[model samples]
Target chain A: MGALHEGHLSLIRMAAAENHRVVVSVYVNPTQFGVHEDLDSYPKTWETDCGMLKDLDKELAEDGNNLGGIAAVFAPTTDTMYPSGRPDQAVNAKGSFVTITPVGEVLEGASRPTFFRGVATVCMKLFNIVMPEKVYFGQKDVQQTVVIKKMVKDFCMNTEVVVGDTQRAPDGLALSSRNVYLGTRRRKVATVLSKILRVAEMSYLREHRLRDELLGPAEQLTKLLLMEQHQLPPEERVNFEIDYISLADPETMQELDEVDETRGAIISGAVKMLPVEVPQPGEDLGLSDGPPVRLIDNIILKPVKL
Target chain B: MGALHEGHLSLIRMAAAENHRVVVSVYVNPTQFGVHEDLDSYPKTWETDCGMLKDLDKELAEDGNNLGGIAAVFAPTTDTMYPSGRPDQAVNAKGSFVTITPVGEVLEGASRPTFFRGVATVCMKLFNIVMPEKVYFGQKDVQQTVVIKKMVKDFCMNTEVVVGDTQRAPDGLALSSRNVYLGTRRRKVATVLSKILRVAEMSYLREHRLRDELLGPAEQLTKLLLMEQHQLPPEERVNFEIDYISLADPETMQELDEVDETRGAIISGAVKMLPVEVPQPGEDLGLSDGPPVRLIDNIILKPVKL
Candidate 1:
């Protein structure tokens, strides 16, 4: 609720403009997280969320916008969201990965096995309860948005899915709710991710080959992004496990062994931060329990043909 | 299509009475039966089924009855019904079993685990294809009617299910297509199944405990109905394979251990006729595969409170 950022605003504004009644559900569903994942620390600011909506409503109202069309904001309790959501019907079971059938078993399915199922189930529940005609998501969560669109089509749902542009900071860092967790210095270097991707996109326009031409620069940029942004050294790259970084077919989301010009390619990546040890003398490895290493961040690059 | 009977006529009549455009689907869905169950030898009376409908239409027309409502008859090919009905997506994998769901796993779930699934799935495909507002069924398949009703409610289906009373012969043999395989003498003894249930109904009305008091008289009546009325011996009663005989809650179709005055009961049963012994000298005991022994019948009884 507190992050009254432009990226979130864009989604709300688009929904308001396009749909008959716009519903902004500000819930960070806990079911999509793994047991060690950050469910408790996820940023939520109801007052700020409400304030942003009120400001938008005032602006729209002054501009002769029908404020009634922008329906009530939905902030559901965790009880309502996760009730009977567990697979075994057990109460307060640890978090599960959200998985979607067929699609969830391939590509992203490989990394977050239960991810898409949790997502599809929760979305279906929300859709059934809300009965929304149109739902909005920012392009920042590109893979999630795509997964949802595919789910709606396959299940024959009536809702229209609208994906807004990924809003970026002035330095070109992708806007995120978790971006608030970055320190002041770490925040500036985070922009390198988008900047390096832009360079890669421009280089791909001039070349067609992957093996000898684009692979070296792409690999270098990937390493540079992790090192420069996360402040992790080359030795730490081994611990900062890169799950997969590859070019794939954009439509079916199937990883391409060889690049084809006819079909578009998506360059996506994911990594888990290795568990860090606190420097203490004879500290029992099991005694001091630090937070578990978490999986985060994904990027997508579409090839440009000049 | 030779077994032209009144049971089939009742379905047609109910369909004509209910809808502006009635489509009577007469296909014997192959997926509903188990491998050992009757599939090949079952009667296929297309000519007679059509003739009976036409004759009923004419008779109703002459009698100034409302019978002009019959619009079409849908007798689809077997391939269309089972194209994707099985659990194995590989064999008839056109996306069969689309209709049935977890709801089919309840009452009929035990005896025919896949039966209700096949029924519901085929019915859904038929319903979608025909776009019918109303569908008809005979009361003889009471469990099937109940299963379908539950499926429709669970799936939020729009079609109305109308059940016609079971049509029976003068001696009380419930009409069925499989009855065609019975010889003249066996067909006479078949009526004993219904007559025994009729006495059971009388016993229930006399405030007799079914299992404790009524089973003796019911079994005796069954033997008497077989011997005196149809000229069969007492040993023939034991030869008839009885599947299940129980009173159940009419709504949920759950078996009630003890009958209550407020709730009604359904007395249902199935029997396998004795196989003929064909002589095989010095080889093995030969059981001649006399006609299909898969005979089923049921009678519903309401409680008479003092």
Candidate 2:
């Protein structure tokens, strides 16, 4: 759970400013990962992450306003976490687990269906262990943040949940530890995810409903098709497959059929990029995944008042 | 959840002895009751219950051992408990709830299927609200006690669960608020429930397996049949029915085939009793259920050292 990226650091910064004590838990929880997903391969730069946290604490302390700093780093082992934690391993794991209804099975998206259960269970465990007054998350994982908020209310958990803004690179690719998995070929086209969301956001301001701008029978299908019109030319980047693009209710994560601006919405998408055959002139790419790199991104959609 | 019976008082006594600050929550959580179950009819003598608790405090304090008394009484209203509690009440009650797996559905008996879910959720709310260092439960509710113990460990909650002994009358009828539901005639036969368990215990002490003693082979079947033989004849008391007599694992609530003493077992039973037709001479039975009253009782089964 810790690469100590700016996105995560931003949440820590917000927690430091707002709370009396800031505690960070940096553990790559195994239960949250699927059998096929990146559990074994997930990032674990513990020493480096701790170092960055120390540096950030020092830098924030330099401001001399004397805000809260990291109080503790709870990094327990998988056995410790799962002593009675995982229900799936019922035979082996003796720990009891907490699960939310309907939401885990549906709202978390059909791909990683059990994802929220893992998240919810672990978060409950952490809340019980840490007994914190407030917990924090980044808005990049909007649906996760929403699910956790619901879980807290449903369980009557005594902790408040706060979401921080999504941090991004200058070129607009949302920063992610998974972004490191996007090798050169996919990395070259990584910004397309944000580009699509940007177009969807702009179209939302004019069209109001993203579904109208995207594929589907209803109003404004032409503008929707226009929004999907790839901004990058075929020669400019390798081909990539669009997994899905839809407007979703921020809280429920259910796809919005008739999108409205009353509570705003989220434009979420995923893309799978194929390996590049030829190197582009004057371009440098970091070594990452040579295989297809699947990346996801989303943006909150609301009309701006003049 | 309060009737101040001996079973409940024993738990209070234990909590008073062990904890630095003891707190008791007295809320008959509505979410745990089914629509048809005794939600409206469930006992609610708040004043009498509070008076008894005050007497308990006085009794404990006069010992002069100097320990904490009942720190607070969390008797929140139904609306407050389910403020965002009942997900099952998706439309009306909006409060979030917590739930555990396996135990609630099976251990609570198939009749009250949603019973454990309601119990688990409300207990989570209470745990979050009170944040007590330790909580006490009566062994009379064997499965509920087991479920809560697992929930605490699984959630990594920093609370210890302590179970108290089951309190019973001299004749062996378990003390319960529902015992009042038994009229003068039915109360005479109430001891039949414990008689069944005693026979089963003797069978287990001899046969080492409750399943064999209660049901199967021809030889043990006679003893097992005797176990089912009620002490009170039909003419002596109102008609009653045994719903089930099953041997189960203490923790998982799963039915046990072969008995083992290492972990012990639970011998649980339920009886559906008819109302007494005539008032017995001289004895007074408080008004209770006009219709049939279904009662349940259980005993822990362990091998006796010879």
Candidate 3:
């Protein structure tokens, strides 16, 4: 539950088309975020979100059929969603939480271990409270969608889950609220992230074999982005800190070594926090007033298995 | 499922009346009965049962009303209900079965500890398959009703449970399939069971103090019947044996120490197999031919607050 974005709005459109009612719940669930994660700074544009819904409602209803079917937008507080105190206590009492170490142990899960658990718990609460016939989630958070699907199946939840494709910027960069934190020069460099992902997607879909064939092109793209597109000097090029890069089974979300029966690969990563020099050892880096940020991007590619 | 006795008929009738469609399941649920128990000989009256339902359907139709009523009778085979294997295996798996020990531990539970678990598992399967708006159970098994209620709450089942009161003979012996096993003389002796329960009810309503005020009478009545009521002389009074006489809380189904909260009492018991000969070394007990039938009886005393 985050602020309204085109990615989330696309999910709402999908929900409205199929279901009798569309209920959008906008709550920045505190349980899903780590103690150091952006729990406080998570964008929460409620008034603007409501305004967007009003505009969408009018637009959908403009076609004389009166499809104005937005039911309720729930923005619950932290206590209201996770009443048993924290996520751990909630999972302990319910014994019905989502976990797929078998699937999540690779890629995105490598960096954020508790990410899927947080997503699963909050989704379960929403499923129970809303009791929606169908719920929609954005594929922008591809790993989240996979985790939620497994949880729903394991728990025998009655709701049908629909995942809409990720909405991207004109430059192919995936839309994220964190993208707002980018400055003029950093924003120009961020375009390379999507550009690298596009290259990986094309190579994997073509006649690329598993390890040597796929890794060669992927490695070349990363090198090209750092050297040419970003125009980083040799010293600055060394500063590019990549979180994780890997091929994974699109369906199960499990990492692949040789791509056996691999339907697709979700190539994803985050640019690490930039280093800052300080006067004292204990002194804060304090780069900007806006706070530190990490830019993330992913491309879902169907592998051509030979 | 054991060949539709009057006990089962009462449940079917309640379902037909309340639900849009009533599915009278007739297959005997083998998983519920424990080993060494009379699972094999637990009655098989399906033909008669079906005829009874046909008559019931005719009666309902003759009234010129068929608003989604008595849709079908689902007598699924044992394999259909317990695809996993049997009741014992099913219950042990993840402890999914209803824990009726809280009530059973006190009264009838001591005699037939696993009885309620079997009942709950079979009932849950029935609820899941039928997905009925409402399911009906007999009050003859009062503790079973309580256990099922708790299970419904614990599992968050959507179906509503309706319990019909205990139906009895003019002499007050609780109607049961096992009653058929009672011989001419044994039949007369069976009336003592009901008479004792009624006495417990009277004593409870009359403000009887001590905890055993109710149990003492039932025990005394059983002893007197074996010694005097039957043709047996005082020395031959070993014909009937009392398994256990217990008083329990109606809500939690746990045994109570004293009759303080006496919102009522579920006075229940089982009659052990009688020895064939008195003062003889292992005579061939008539229990083999007639089988040492286990008969259970319960009476809910009016609330008697201490």
Candidate 4:
């Protein structure tokens, strides 16, 4: 969880501005990853992460404003987090677990069944450990923000959940530690996730509230990308697979047929990128074998006075 | 949960004596009750419950010692507890829930599968809502205390869990709101639950550490009760059904084949009572119809310096 990208920094900065003290919890949280997903491959830049936090603190201090800097960093071992035993990655794994239903079982959760359970469980543990007055999350993971909010509301936890705006690259790719996994070509193509969400956002801004109207162009663009890749020579093709494109109620994460004018909605999606041919020896092509690199992004539609 | 018997009062008194403020929550959490269980029939003497708390506060105030009294009573409705629709009574019901495993799946949990899930979930909600420094539970519910302790440790909750000794009647029957359901004849027989637990406790103190040695007499007593009821005339018999008698590790709630003298153990059991015949018109015989009135009790074996 601690690659220390701009997205993570944004939340930290927001927390620093508001609270007298800020504690950052940097945990990979194994329970959230599916067995087949990239737990081992997930980035762990502890030294660089600390350096980044230090730099951010110095910058805040240099600004000559009274604001809280990093008070401490909570980097717990696996044993400390789970004293009983590590939770099984299986959906029905037997152990102490916190689960949010219906809200957690769609989109990302639907794709990776045990993910939200792991996220909710770990977050609950962290909240208890830190006992913070406020917790911050990046809107990059939209459904996760919704799930955590629901957990806090339903469980009556005292901490407030603050969502920071998603930080993005100049090319429009959402900032993520997993972004390092993208090879050169795949990196270029990765922006399509944000591109499609923007497409959906543009349609929403145009007052196209119907599900089909909002998602049509985005779906068509994904199909076109696949079509273009298939037309290329097999060895030259860069494959794309869209997992889901959701227009959903922000509170419940329920897929919506039409956006509510009063509450607005969130348009989110996930896509996988793969190279068709295995890389030759000494090849510099950015290609990965086995599981494809999955990227997700979302956009929030503010309620409009219609 | 608001019958306010001696068992509940002991916990309240303990809390008042220890902390500067004590908050008693009185909600018969629906999620904890199975559809066939006593959700509707469970006692709800709110006025009387408040009266008892008031009486206890007055007594605490008269002691002239510096101690806390009842600061507030949190009595949330089902809708307040479950903002999303109330969780289905089914085990696999779809909704937000907290689950503790292995520990929650044995002894009482094995008999009532969904019981601990409801308990863990509701306690989590209450803990978050109250955020008390310490929470009190009666040891009459041995498995519940163990499960809650595990949840607090595993979740890293801040509240210290305090267990009050099980308050009992002069005849050794554990005080419970459900005792009202026992008829005069069945009420006398109800003492068998504590009697069996005491039997196991006595054997443990005698260094009968093996499972069979410790539980043999207790189980035999239950068997004898059932046997004696069978020998009685059909209409005259007050039936006794032994659900389970467990000698378990107090920490994990795992059934132990042999008690570890250093760690000690807990001996607990549940028994169901039924009146074998319908009550005649104008009869005031203390008997109930429909589902059996189940009673549970337990005793702790102190760790021996072996």
Candidate 5:
């Protein structure tokens, strides 16, 4: 997970600000990806990532009294991390592995079934390896942050888990490593993800409608808005789809039947972008020369809004 | 896991002797048991466990330089540990939980499918809560000890998992919590578990037959030996049964297809003993007052003989 976007940098900056020492792990965990998922195509810019880390360290140390700096970077190979060998055929792996139970089955997990199991397992391994006093994560992956928090608490792990606010592009698209997948034209339109969620948030605040009832329509409306607002030609709009838009109780991650007066909610969604492709003479990029890349973004909607 | 026999005490003593402080957790973890297993009938002797611990500390302290003392006893309630709630229906439990995959599926795990998952998860939870420098386990539960070692190494847990030599009674029956289930008569025959394993270990050393070929007849020979050695009346022998007998790789917990002369093997077995009734006439002791208690024991057969 090492393409070092501002969102990840924010967590690093926060960790540097808060802790005396920091260690960042930069490995694309393989177990987390399904057989058909983007294990191969996912970004890997280790050199750039290290340069950014060095810059951030210099920047942090330069801030007068800001003393925290990265102590190390754990970049383990697949063989080193999974000594039982690759988890491709997990059932036969010789090592003892970690899994997060039911919490791994909702929302994001529903879309990517094995996602949190991989996240929780790797995080636990990282926590053990680094033995950190505190850990930080970006809030863009709200479900993932929550799942890690549960693992820390349930396991009684010593480190504190801190969630930093999600960083965003100038146009408001959540900063993500996958953002590289967006074509120049689609990248401009990527802001639609947060825009749609913000719209749902405003609607929930004004209407006080049950989340379940509201989110379903909000998802459908986002499609209409995409068509009308983008003013894209029919051919350009052909392969686009909104995977899911959900309003769920933040901690439990269960989709709320209705928003009560007290507890707030989290609005999350994933979208597949059909962007202008970089044409190759012989290659088909599957849906208009742009690989169908899934981008996820989320925002918290405080139910008792002031 | 609170029966606190010599096997458990040996581990506690080892932990105390080696580390600066020792904490013994006595909760009977519910997740590790199957619905039909003996979770309900499992023994809980908290007071006696504490008494033994206090006695061990005094014995260790009296020897004068054993600086490590009991700093805490983290006997958490089910609610305290699994804040996500009890793992009664683990699949849907809200809190994050841990699992040690494949290794949990070999050998003992093959018989008790969910057993090692429960063991790995709880041990991780305990490791987090205790944050120990070193952890200890009796070698009697060889498979459990092996699974935990894999977890510690794989996850990079900070603590060292030290395996203590298995402790036994004067008669050489491996001490276990379930031994309490044996009525006086069957308790006498309960030694059969270790007795059979001892014979197998000797046979393994004496004969170089392939493990799979040898173990099958070794098991059949144990039943014959049990009848001949005890010379039990046919009435008493009817209720006893051999659950499984295996020769396995100690590290992987995989049943060895054949033994390599460089690395030895572990001879393990479990036997269910149905003893004479506890003689409370009107009590209606459903399964004939003598509980069907399953006891497990094992021995390491080093290939290089003197």
Candidate 6:
């Protein structure tokens, strides 16, 4: 999926630094999207994406590095990705699919049941097609990184998975293609996702190791945000729905009641931003109508000797 | 899986001929077996298996072929194949699994629902680990060959899949490790699987293209075999249970009501052999007492101009 944002660019840049030739696969795998998810509305900035890649290559050339900059951009069509015809987004939809469970069945997968199934299946296909020695993924989708790693390990795929730190806005909103769907007000509110994760991270860093202690403030802040929105004038209010605030084992993605002192843990969450009412005739405040803009972010807690 | 029967040898020899080195995986994949299926009883002639490979290498050396004999035998432990712990054999068992549907769902799949899922999953792991230029499968497992090919194509796997002709005993019985469990009487009747497939193949070659017309004689022969077995004395009888007699498209594994003359089809079936009585103290006939020994075989019809 390519809107060529700063986040995607970071992964590409990282890949270029490591490998001599990097193949970028720009595919909005339909199999990965849920029936109601943003397959149609998902950004497709092809011309801009290509231009950005070219610009990145020029920038790398200027850097005087021996590393190759983007050898080929594999922009395959839906037809190429799913030659057996596009897979049905429904959970039970049949065809060729790769599924990783336990890890895939929690959090994001629990919310969007078939989401990781689609992700794993597409990633496997891409891995086979590109056959890259190393693959890069943004930590923005933390659980996705875990799922892919597990799939690669479990399937014995001869590819290394590299994780790039999440790129964020000045407000700490995780950079995402879906971010474009956020209206002005919703955009401001979406940062709450990353905010809560940070709060949990700060708590964990302060040695508040108990699961409840770590997640308590984050949950409280989410509730307070909802309450504050409820008190606002209905038309001006933005509804915030917190999907999950998870402190999980990074390897298995299994919810951890308490983070292992040595292994640490990943604190992550998803929040949906929805405008209470469509922007009035006088005010077009950049509010979307169909589905809420779901924002997700995560923080990795390093192990502490304490 | 390493009983090292002629069928397995054929695949190994074919692979050796095509590639510089051949890695033989001899793990009895537990994931592929159903819970009640013979996971425990399934033969584990590892020492004999290695001996056979060595013997094959000697023969290859004697042949003066430039092709390398067995270079390595990758006999991974169960823990190695399923690092996240062994996957449960139950249908709904969750883990990382690769599934090819439609093709994987019909024919043999319908009989053993999760059979192809395990096959596809394990094959993916093996392909990734070995990264072979070409892989080989014996045509004795016709449906399995189809499933693996579809998985490779669907996943865009790099390796080419080559099908070795089914190796058979003098009686036209497809050679299989499971044959050893058939005992003497059951072994004789097990040949019925291949015989019926040959009947269907002969019918197709003679231009008897109609579905029922082609299957009629073959099915009648099976029924006649069962009737004959029924007429035998209780101690002498061997049970013949036909799981299925399928005339299916070679590509999709979908049952074909009528053979597609141009595209051709596969004639296949599975027959279970069960001894009616336990071996008495005096009677030392080689008859098994546990679950029926299932034997499968198939014949491919070449597409005809007429």
Tell me the lDDT of model 6 at B296: 89
- Which residue pairs in candidate 3 collide? B103-B253, B104-B109
Using DockQ, rank the candidates from best to worst. 6, 4, 5, 2, 1, 3
Residue-wise C-alpha lDDT for candidate 6, range A158-200, written one tens digit per residue: 8999999999999898998887777666777778888888889
True contacts kept of each: 0.00, 0.54, 0.00, 0.79, 0.74, 0.88
Segments of candidate 5 deviating more than 4 angstroms? A65-67, A89-95, A207-209, A226-238, A275-289, A303-306, B65-67, B89-95, B207-209, B225-238, B275-288, B303-306
Candidates 4 and 5: which is better by DockQ?
Answer: 4
> How would you encode candidate 1's per-residue C-alpha lDDT over B151-227 as one tens digit per residue?
45433456788888999887788887777565544565566667667777777778775454545666787666445
DockQ each candidate and list the results.
0.10, 0.41, 0.06, 0.82, 0.62, 0.86
Query: What TM-score does prediction 3 earn?
Result: 0.57
Candidate 2, A1-306: lDDT as tens digits: 987799999998898888768889988766666666767677678999989999988876776564688888888887768775345522223234455545455533456655766778788888888888899998887777887888787666788999888899998988887777666556656787777777767767666564766424322432343354445454455666667776787766677776666767887777776665455774444434354567778888764443
B-chain TM-score, candidate 5: 0.88
Q: Candidate 3 falls in which docking quality class?
A: incorrect
Per-residue C-alpha lDDT of model 4 across residues A1-306, encoded as one tens digit per residue: 898899998888888888879899999999999988889877789999999999998877776563788899999998999988897898879888999988999999999999999999999999999999999999999999999999998888888999999999999999988877666656777888888899999999998999999999999888877787788776556788888999999899899999998999999999987653655455445423424788899999888976
TM-score of each: 0.59, 0.83, 0.57, 0.96, 0.91, 0.96
- TM-score of structure candidate 5: 0.91
**Could you tell which candidate, 1 or 2, scores higher by lDDT?**
2
Stronger candidate by TM-score (2 vs 3): 2
Which is the winner by lDDT between candidate 1 and candidate 5?
Answer: 5
lDDT at A238 for candidate 6? 81
Q: What is the lDDT of residue A212 in candidate 1?
A: 32
Write the residue-wise lDDT of candidate 3 on B1-306 in tens digits: 655566766666666565567777666766567666777777787778778888777766665444434688888876666553343433233222334334434455556556765676667667656767777777777777887776554345676778887877777777877766654445656666667677777777777746678778877777776667357664344466767666766776666667555466566666653433433344333333446666677777657445
Deviation in Å, model 1, residue B297 alpha carbon: 2.3
TM-score, structure 2 vs. true: 0.83
Off by over 4 Å in 3: A1-11, A24-68, A73-132, A135-306, B14-21, B27-45, B59-69, B77-90, B94-133, B150-159, B169-171, B177-196, B219-246, B257-265, B269-295, B303-306
Which residue window of length 10 is worst by lDDT in model 2 chain A? A217-226
Across B73-139, the per-residue lDDT of candidate 4 in tens digits comes to 9999888888776888898898889999988999888878889999999999899888889999999
